[model samples]
Target: MQKGAEAVHAANPDVLVILSGLNFDKDLSFLRQRPINLTFSGKLVFEIHRYSFTDGKSWETGNPNQVCGQVVNDIMSRGGFLLDQGYPLFVSEFGADQRGTNVNDNRYFNCFLGLAAELDFDWALWTLVGSYYLREGVVGLNEVYGVMDWNWCDIRNSSFLKRISTVQSPFQGPGYNESRSHKLIFHPMTGLCVRRISFFQPLELGPCSESDAWDYTPTKTLTLTGTYFCLQADKSGQPAKLGIMCTNSNSKWQAISDSKMHLSSKLQDGTNLCLDVDSKNVVFTNTCKCLSKDKTCDPASQWFKIIDSTRKQNTTKSFFQSKQIAQFLGNTFSYIL
Candidate 1:
């Protein structure tokens, strides 16, 4: 494999040489002992593939949290460790059945997504064609994991795309451009974004690009950029408006759930209210409703996706592999986008 990689590098110094994990490309534990040496600089990348069935030891039968913890550890031991090594690692393939009835796949997918969000790892979904033109001796073979419909006219699953879109753009990473110094609050449901016109103004929905920059502290306080105005809540059932940066409980909010879809808080009345928008497009706290249970529930007004609005043009250090450089290199280094 090294000889082949070296020959490829020799042919084109700028071309990326991809090294897949050993044994069905499931793990790269060997790299911990032996790192690859390419002929060129900044053109080596590692690739790995994963699926719901790969780590199947019964993710459905065990406690989701416990199983998720165990599986995450295993993943870290395998290809996930590459991220810590500061080398670009791509999830060359990962997907679940689009038919959406596989319990193991569904559970494992949630766990996988949680890890993907935290690491901001680049990835590519497993299949793209809903039905194959031909495979083996069979004609018109169906690929349940495909992103497109059987006719290839439209996306097979838009909700899945939207669910995965949260990590589509990175929040924190080595290559984050600091020039913008802003974060946009996004709610995928309505596709409307949260923004502010000025200080002491009510935050409203707008184009995500036009959204205001917000600062989310570890303590869960959201303060507007370059201002003392922090997000706080008024009485329950009322629109949450901007107020002075307060040390009280009203300013506290948190991203709850494994997917971090729910931005919720506890009110003085002890009701667990979530940040939501009514049909009138007003921001307020309401009951923490289920997002995936009912598509007709129309909870877009409640979901908030906080994204980094910075330029991300700069690379932090050698640990940081710029996505642009990876793209410039070649398709050998696989990624979703």
Candidate 2:
């Protein structure tokens, strides 16, 4: 592999040389013992592939939080650690069944998205093609993982596309000059973030780019950055509101599930409720469900991940105004944006 990388750089020094790890491009932990040596400095990249099947039905049987934590740790130990070592790491292939019925794939995606948002690494979806002309003696095989429909006329899953769109832009890193740190309550199932319209209005889920910056304080209160109001709840099924009385137990949130995705708070009556969204996109608090061992229940609606970001709030509007500017920013940030 080293010789091949050297030859590629020798032939074309201008192009980046991406190295793949052994064991189907999923293990690069070996590099920790022996670093790569090349004449070039800035153009070397490492790549890895991951999927729901990579760990063989673990997502189906195990708690998502535990499964995700274990998998992410393994990935970091493998090739993801290279990022900490100052080298670019690319998720060359990662995708899920877009049909939305595969339980394993569905569970894996929530876990995968959290890591993606945290690391903000460069990645390539497994494919764009909806169908194959032939594969292994089969004719016209349909690719369930493809982003497009088999006819190639429309998106196979628009919601899935929307969910991934949040990570399409960089939250930090090169060309992202923002220095302020804040949290965005991201809903992987909806591809939106928690947002507020006014002081007394109920909170709603909206475009992540318009998400309100939040602070997860030491007291476990979710406060709007630079504001006195904090997220509060009263009943188990009422809308989660912003209020100045933040010291109450109803306003103190905790990550309660194994996946640590469910943000729960104790109601005044001692009932534990989780952050949730309704069909109309209203954010609310409801009875915490499926904390563990229950695979039949779908907890996607209650899953909220509070991810850190350093994105400049003031400049994001301009970045969305022009496609040219968005593309320029993406390129200028190098491989990770």
Candidate 3:
């Protein structure tokens, strides 16, 4: 493997030479003993694969927080140690059963996601195929772990994708660290995120990792990165977007709940419009009657968790710079072991 890696670099000095982990593809613990002596600059990367099934002793029945702590320790010791060694460690394979009903898988996945986010590890999710052409003489066998539907038309489990989105992008990677300063206004109902695609586009929810960084100011307004636009609301029933200079009170927001789930923005003349997802999945201001009148009222779409980014962020990458790097790394980051 070393010879092959060296040969690849020798043929193309600018290309990154990736080394797969040894010993059931889970053992990078050997790196603690020695180094992968790839003399090329920015050309050495290590990869490891993990599944919840490998060592799921107490994942299903134990306290989730306790299990998450234990599992994260194991992952750091085994493969995540590479990050400290000044090399990127890619989690090449990690996925769960898509049925959303498996107790073991469901628990293990939440634990896995916690570790991924805390470490800011670059990883890939397993699967895209739902039904197979043929497998062991059986046709149309269902693969519940697949991301696609049986007919390969729609996403099989959107919530699963949303949960994984928080880790796909590097909040803290090699170059930038100030990203911890931003907050992810995560919507719990649709399991999506609030992002501004363009200055003219309304603030909408999409995959969280792919979303842009947002600065929730002390003045109570949201500032979108890579632009001068800030979130603005024109009226009570209208959609919000990146516009206006963010000087008005309508742009300001406050936490109305003790748990900090409710983000209430002020309307003109002193009425408060709570931030909620509309029927179109767009974020806007609405009534906050449930907060005081009905405790059990389903106001989840208006619910958002402002997750403080706890890790460092990769330095700001311009489109051309990112494109150049992507060219060297190829079109995809996910790969099977």
Ranking by lDDT: 2, 1, 3
Cα lDDT for residue 66, model 3?
47
Top candidate when judged by TM-score against the true structure = 2
**Candidate 3 segments whose C-alpha is farther than 4 A from its true place:** 174-337
User: What are the per-residue Cα lDDT tens digits for candidate 2 across 1-337?
Assistant: 8899999989998999999988988999999999988777999999999999999998898777667768988999998899999998899999999998988999889888877887888888977889989987888899999998999999999988888888988877778757587888888878788987654468999987788899999999999887666898878788998766689898999987766788999987888889999999999999988777766676778988888888754233333345543553455456544
lDDT (CA) for every model shown?
0.68, 0.84, 0.68
Of models 1 and 2, which has the larger TM-score?
Answer: 2
Q: Per-residue lDDT for 10 in model 3?
A: 86
Residue lDDT tens for model 1, 108-150: 6766775665566788888788888898777988788899888
Q: Candidates ranked by TM-score, best first?
A: 2, 1, 3
Better of 1 and 3 by TM-score: 1
- lDDT digits (tens) for residues 54-128 of candidate 3: 776565655444454566677778888888878878888888899887766765675565456545677877888
- Backbone clashes under 3 angstroms, per model: 5, 2, 3
Model 2 residue 68 lDDT score: 71
Backbone clash pairs for candidate 3 read 171-313, 172-312, 176-315
Q: Model 2, 1: alpha-carbon shift in Å? A: 2.8
lDDT leader: 2
Off by over 4 Å in 1: 57-59, 62-73, 101-118, 162-178, 184-211, 233-242, 254-337
